[model samples]
Target: MTVLNEPATLLNGSAWTSHVFLGEWTPGSGGDYAVVEPATGKELARLGSATPGDVGRATARAVDAQRAWAAAGYQERAAVLRRAGALWEEHAAEIEEWIVREAGSVPPKAALEVRTAAQECYEAAALASHPVGEVLRSEQPRLSYSQRVPAGVVGVIAPFNFPLILAIRSVAPALALGNAVVLKPDPRTAVCGGVAIARIFEAAGLPAGLLSVLPGGADAGEALITDPAVRIIAFTGSTRAGRAVARLAGEHLKRVHLELGGNSALIVMADVDVARAASAGAFGSFTHQGQICMATGRHLVDRRIADDYVAALAERANRLPVGDPSGGQVALGPIIDVRQRDNVHRLVTASVDAGARLAAGGTYEDLFYRPTVLADVPLEAPAYAEEVFGPVAPVVAFDTADEAVALAADSEYGLSLGILSGDGLKALELAGRIPSGAVHINDQTVSDEAVIPFGGTGLSGNGSRMGGIAHNLEAYTETRWVTAQSELPEYPY
Candidate 1:
C-alpha cells in the first residue's frame, strides 16, 4: 500500500502505477484521457482509459479471483469492509476534496456523499455475518436447506452524478458477499467514482483481482454487460442506457439490477404553510443542481394556493447563489458539462416558448445554471414531461387530491415522491394511491439510507432493490437448494 496526501498526487500515482487494477498495478493498453473539472472547465488530470479488450481481460481475471474470495471466511471478508469504512472516514478530507472538484459538488453535498459512502461500507460489512440460508421441512426423511452463494463476478456501471455513493453502494456489498467486481465508471468522473474506491480497498488489504476499476466509454460498458464470466450487473444511470444494458445482458442470460432515471413529483396541499412547503420543494429540486435521479422534477400544488406556493418557491430560487463550489459559499454548483447545461437550458427554453411562465431562473452563465421555477407549465411541456436533471422545477396546478394523483401518476417514471399537508393521514392515503417506490409525507422527495431498500418502479428501474441485508443478498448472490440423506431412497426407474 502507498500513502497519498493530495488529490493530484493520488491521481498521478494511479495513472503512472496502474490504469486498471488486475491483481496488481497494471497500465492500460488503451491511451490516456484527460479529466476536466466541471466547475472551471480546466484539465485536472490525465488517466489511462480502458478499452473493451481491457474490460474482457478484467472480467477473466475477476472470474479466477472470485473462487478464492468466496472460499475465504465470513469474518475475513467482513473485516475488509469494516476497514474500508474506517479508511473512508480517516481520509475524509482528501476524499471530499476529490469529490468536490471531480463531481462539481458543493462542500456540504460532497461531505454528505463521503459520509454516505462510509455508511454503505459499514452496512455491507454487516451483511457478511447475516443469515445466508434457510432450513426447510423434508417429507422424505432428508435434511433440506437453501443457502446463498456468490454470483461470481459482478459488473458495476455507475453514472457521473453522485458518483461515489452509486458505485460503492453496489461495490462494497458485492465484495462483502464474496463476489469479485469489474467496475465501469463514467469517464468524466472516473477518479472519484473509480480510483478512490480502488485505493480504499487496496489500503484495506482487499485481495488482488477481487476488484477492478476500469473507467471507459460505452464500448467498455457494453463489453462488461456481454461478458460471460460476469454473472450479475448493477447499473445506475439514464433510463435509455439502462435499457440498453438490460437488453444486452438479457441476451447473454445474465442478471441485471438497474437504478435508472426519474421524473419524481412533490405534492403541496392547500392546508400547509406556503412558505414551508416551498422550502421543501426548493430543497428537492435545487439540491446538487437537481442532478439526482430522485430530484423533484414536478411540483403539484392545490389550485387554491398554487399562486402563493409558486411565488414563495421563486423567492427561494432567486436567492440561492450558483457558482464554482470550490471558490466560495454557494447553493448550487455547475452542471457536469456543457452538454448537460445545454440540455437543461433547452428544456427551459422550449417550455417557455410553449407558454410556460418562467417564475424565476431559466438562465445560465457558462455551466452555472440558476435554480429555475416554471409556473403554469403545461402537461406536455418538455421540462414538465421529461426528467430535466437540472435545477429547474415545473409547477402545475391541481384542483383536487384526485387530480394531484392523476398528475403525479402521468409520468413514465415512478421513482420517488413527496406530499406536504397539515394532516398526516391524508398525506399517507394520498401516498398509497401513487405508484412510486419511495414516498415522503410532509417532506421532500430526495432521501436515502444505507439500511433501507432503495430502488424504483416502471422506467425508473427493474423490480430489484439495492440496499439492506436481504436486498443486497438478493442482488449479489444466488440461492441453492441442497438436501442430505443417510441412506439412499427407493428409486423409480
Candidate 2:
C-alpha cells in the first residue's frame, strides 16, 4: 500500500499545511480507515483518525475568520465565490476521481455532484447581491423593516452518503449568508470535500481564514457544537447523531438546521399501473444501494393488487444489472462496504426469524448483498418498523385508503413520499392527508428537480433544502428590526 505523505495542501492564499493537520490517527493508535476501490477490494489509501483537538483548532479558525470575512463587504465576498466556482469547474475532473475513490460513488453520480458543486457556488454568489430584508409596508405607527445580518460562525457536520452534495448544501448557503464556516465532513469521505473546497476557494480569491475544514470522526463533530464561537449548527446524519448535535448547540443557544434519518413509504392505489409502481419501487429502494435518507423502503399497496405489484417489481429489480459500479451495464453498485451490508443482512434475518415470509432475495455475503425484497413482512417487523437503509423493499397490502394513509404515516420520519394513482386529483387529496415533506403523484422519490425545498417533517429533519426555499439566508443570518427613523421611547413607565 502507498501512503501519500503530503496527501494534498490546504490553501488560504500562498500559505499551505503540508501534512493533514486535522487530527489524523497515528500508526500505533490502531485507528486506521481505508478508502477501497469498490470494483476490486484493493486498498487505495489509509487515513489517520481525527482527534478532538483538531476539531477545536478548525472551529477556532472558522470562527475567528468570520469577523474579517463578514467585514469584506458584499462585492469582495461575491468575487471570492465567483472565483471559486471557476476554479472548481476547471479542476472538476480531479475532484470526480476523489469522489469515486473515497466514497465509491458511481461515475455518473460523481460527475453530477462535481457539476452541482460549481452551480452551488455560482448560485450562492448571486444570493450575496440581494439584501436580506426590505420594507414590506410603510405606515405611521413606526417605520418597520427587517434586516438580516450574520449569525456569527456556523458549524456544519455532514454525512458520507452523498458527501459532495451535503457539504455544498451546508457550506454554500452559510457562506452566501456571510457566515464563516467550520465544516466537519464524514471521516471516510473527507478527501472529496477538501479538494472541492480547495478548487473553489483558490479560484474565488476567498480570504484564507473564511473557510476551515476539519475531517475526523464523531469527536470532531461534538467539538464543533460545544464551542462558544460557533453560533449555528447544520447537520445531516442519523437521528441519534442529530439529536446529540441539537442538544449541544441548544446549550449555547445556537441556530440549528438538521436533516436526519428517514424510511419513506411509497403508496400505490388501484388506479395506477402495477408496472409503473413496480418500476418506481425498484429505482427508489435500490438506487445508491438504498443509502439515501429519503429513499423509499416501504411499499403500501392496494390489497387487491399487492400480489401482481410485487411480482412485477421482482422482475424489474432482478433484471437490473448489479455488480461493479464501473461497468456501464450496471445500474446499481455494491453496498457502500461490509458494515452496511451486514446491517441490512441482520435486519432481514431477524424479520424472517420472527415469522415474516421472505418473498425475494435472502442472499447476503461479503462487500455486497443482492437486491432484497420482503413480503408478508408485518408492519411491526424490524425491517418494516425501522429504516431499512439497504437494497430491501417490503410490500404490505392495505385494504382501504385510510389503511394506506395509516401505513404510510406509520413512521415518525416524514422526509419524502410518492403515490402512484391514475387519478391526479385523488393523488393530490391523498398527498395532503399523508404527512410528508414533499409528495409526487406519478414520479419516484429521486425525481427531485433543483427548485423545491427538499426536507422532511418530525425526525426526518428540522427544516428543508434546495428548491428556492434557499432561504439559506435564514440559517446564516440573524434578523434585526432596523429603525432608520430614530425616535425616543414615548414613556419609560
Candidate 3:
C-alpha cells in the first residue's frame, strides 16, 4: 500500500497531527494554538490545547490502562514494542520531515533523531521479557525475593530540542515496563513528538488508553506534573523548568526524573592534532544549531595551541552553510523561535562586551544565527558561565592541566565533557577529575547512545539517569520484597 520513493504518499491529511487520548484523535477542549516553522517563519500547524480537566481525564484513563497493560505479561508487551520499532523504521522519512519542519533541525540532525528513536524502541523491546526480580538469601526456612513492578502512571514532559529522540528515550522504556504514559510534548514540535509517536504505537497494537499525547505550553505541563494519579514524572528541559517540575512533583511526593540543561566543555591538550580537535569541536558546538544540552559551550584549550585551534575552529564555523532546513543542504538551521534566537543574540552581545573577542561570527538573519566562536573569554562572561544553547563556542586558554580540569569543573551544569589528547592516560586522568555525567576521551562533548546511562549531575539533573537499563530502575518501576515462610516464627507481636 506504499511506494518506496514517494514521500508525499505518507503525508496525507492530518495524518501527522497528534492530539490523542484513549486511542482516538479527540479534539482538545481548551484553548487553540498555532506553531510557526522557524525555517520559513510560516505557520506550520494550528492545534488544540489541553486544560486541567483534560489532564484529569487522561490521568484516570492512564490509571485504568496501566493496570490492564501490566497484567498482559512481558511477552505481549514485547511483541507490541517490537512492532512499534518496525513501524518507526518504515515511517522514518516522514518522521524526519516532521522533525525538520517542527523543530528547525537540519537534515542530518533530523535523520539522527528519527534513527535514534527507532533504535530506542527496539532496545526497549529486548528488555521486555528480561529478568526483573532477584532472589535473596534467608537464614530461616523461608524464601525471599524482590521484584520490580510497574509504577502506576508516568508523565513524560519533553523539550523542543531533540523532541523525538528525547521523548522516545523515556517513552519506550516506560511502555516496555508496563506503565501507562501521559506524554506532554513541547508545543513547538508537537507534530513529531506527539502525533508521529502516538500514531506509530497505536498502529503497532498498543492497547487503547495506554499512551496519551497532549501538546501544549506550560499550563499543560503543570497539569500533567501535578496530577494525583500520575505516580512518576520524567522531564527533559532547561534547568529552570526542571526545577519547577521538581518542586511541583515534590508537593505531590511523586517520583521525578529530570535531564536538565548543560554547559559542557571541550578540552584540547597540547599533544593532540589541532586540526582534528578543531573539527571535532566545531561539530560538538554547532550540531543541531547547538540546541543540544550536551553541545560544547566552552572550549578550554592548552595555551600553547589555543591560537591555532581557535583559528581552525573558526574556519570550520565560518564555512558551514546556514539556511532553511527544508533545503536539506545546510549544516545549521534556524532557532526554535524568535525568543530563543534573541536570547542567543543577547548572550553573544554581552559576552563580546565583557572582553571576549568575536573570533568568527556574531550575526543572524531572521532566526538563523551563524556558528559563533569567541576567543579570550573571561570566566565571568555569560558565554563562559551559562548554557547558551545556541551555535556559540567561547574559547578559553588554560596554562596547566590543573587549570584545564578546574575550568571544566567550574560550570554549574555538569552534563557532559570532552577531552581530546594524544596521550590516552592524560585524557583519562583529566576525565577522572571532571564532575560530569559523561566524559568522552578523544571525542566531542555531543555524544549519546541508546544503551548508556545518559544524564547529568548538579543542576543538569536531579540524580536520575535518562537512558539505558539503569534508568528503568528509577523511572518505570518500583521494587517490592516478598517472603514465603514454611513454618511460623515468633515475632515481637
Per-model TM-score versus the true fold: 0.97, 0.89, 0.96
Which of 2 and 3 is ahead in TM-score?
Answer: 3
By TM-score, how accurate is candidate 3? Answer: 0.96
Instruction: Please give, for residues 192-219, the per-residue lDDT of candidate 3 as tens digits.
Output: 8877787778777788788988886688
For residues 1-493, write the lDDT of model 1, one tens digit per residue.
Answer: 2233324334445444436666565677677788889999888877768889998889888888889889999998999898889888887888788788889999999999889989999999999999999999988889999999999999999999999999999999999999999999888888888888988887788888889999878888998998889999999999998899989999999999999999999999999999999999999999999999999999999999999999999999999999999999999999999999999999999999989999999889989999999999999999999999999999999999999999998889999999999999989998898999999999999999999999999999997999999999999999999999899877898
lDDT of each: 0.91, 0.72, 0.86
Instruction: Mark the regions of model 2 whose C-alpha exceeds 4 Å error after superposition.
Output: 1-18, 21-34, 46-49, 136-143, 447-450, 464-470, 486-493
lDDT for each residue of candidate 2 in 1-493, tens digit (9 for 90 to 100): 1112222433221232222332121231225466566556777565445566766665666777778777767877777666667666776777777676567667777788878777777777787777678775666556778888888888888788788888886787678777887777786676676535643564455555567666666766777788888888888889878888788888878778888888888988987888878988888888777888888878888989998988887787667666666645566667767777788888999988876777677675465566777887777788888887788888889999988988887788888888888888887888888788878878776654333466778888876554343466766788888655567657678
**Counting only residues 3 or more apart in sequence or on different chains, how many pairs clash (N, Cα, C under 3 Å) in candidate 3?**
1
Clashing pairs in 3: 18-195
TM-score order, best first, reads 1, 3, 2
Tell me how candidate 2 scores on lDDT. Answer: 0.72
**RMSD, one per candidate, in order:** 2.0, 4.8, 2.7
Better of 1 and 2 by TM-score: 1
